[model samples]
Target: MQLQLQTLPKVLSVLVMEDRIDAASAIQFKERLRDLTQEGDQRVVLDLARVQFLDSSGLGAIVAVKKLLGPDRVLELSGLTPTVERVFRLTRMDTIFTIHLTHEAALSDVTGA
Candidate 1:
């Protein structure tokens, strides 16, 4: 799993450069995200543009990340492919986290652009 971490003013953008976030890489994802968000910006956006698939394990990992971030921090998701989006929708995670159509849109939302 490759991740491009960027700091944009009040937000930390984590662009996941992979097609799937399944049982295989979920743990790593969680660990890496934990390391990145330890003491930085409270606003985080996960870019899932390249991710076309997500399983229960992956979903759990995402939720775990959000919970781990605590109440003060916000974790948003962006660029979910239809398949991936459906998983979140079916699991009712769409209501739990904010979803954006694009990374730029998420950035705009946080940056007030």
Candidate 2:
């Protein structure tokens, strides 16, 4: 559950420093995300470029984070691996989330820079 947190002007960027997000780490993932975002009102960008694998539990945890953020604060995902992207696509979760191809793109969209 190693995560790098970067606080930008308009966003809180959380870079997932793990290669896999599976059942074993799903709870930790959710807990860590919750802890990191508990005080922020800004948009959250979850950068998963290092994550090569994601299971259903992992996906569920992500969705839970979105819900936890409520309507005002958004949880955006970026830098998804091909396999992780496919899971989101197949599950149609892609439609529910604002996903960006890269971390820079997500920041650009939020910061309008």
Top model number, lDDT: 2
Collision pairs in model 2: none
Clashing residue pairs in candidate 1 (N, C-alpha, C atoms within 3 angstroms): none
lDDT tens per residue, model 2, 1-113: 99999998889999999999999999999999998999969899999999999999999999999999998899999999999999999999999998999998998894422
For residue 28, give model 2's deviation from the true position in Å. Answer: 0.5
- Tens digits of per-residue lDDT for model 1, 1-113: 79999887788899999898999999998998888899875599999999988999999999999999998888999999999999999999999998999999998884422
lDDT of each: 0.90, 0.93
Worst 10 residues of 1 by lDDT: 104-113
Task: Predict model 2's lDDT versus the native.
Answer: 0.93
Candidate 1 stretches greater than 4 Å from native: 111-113
List RMSD in Å for every model shown. Answer: 1.7, 1.6
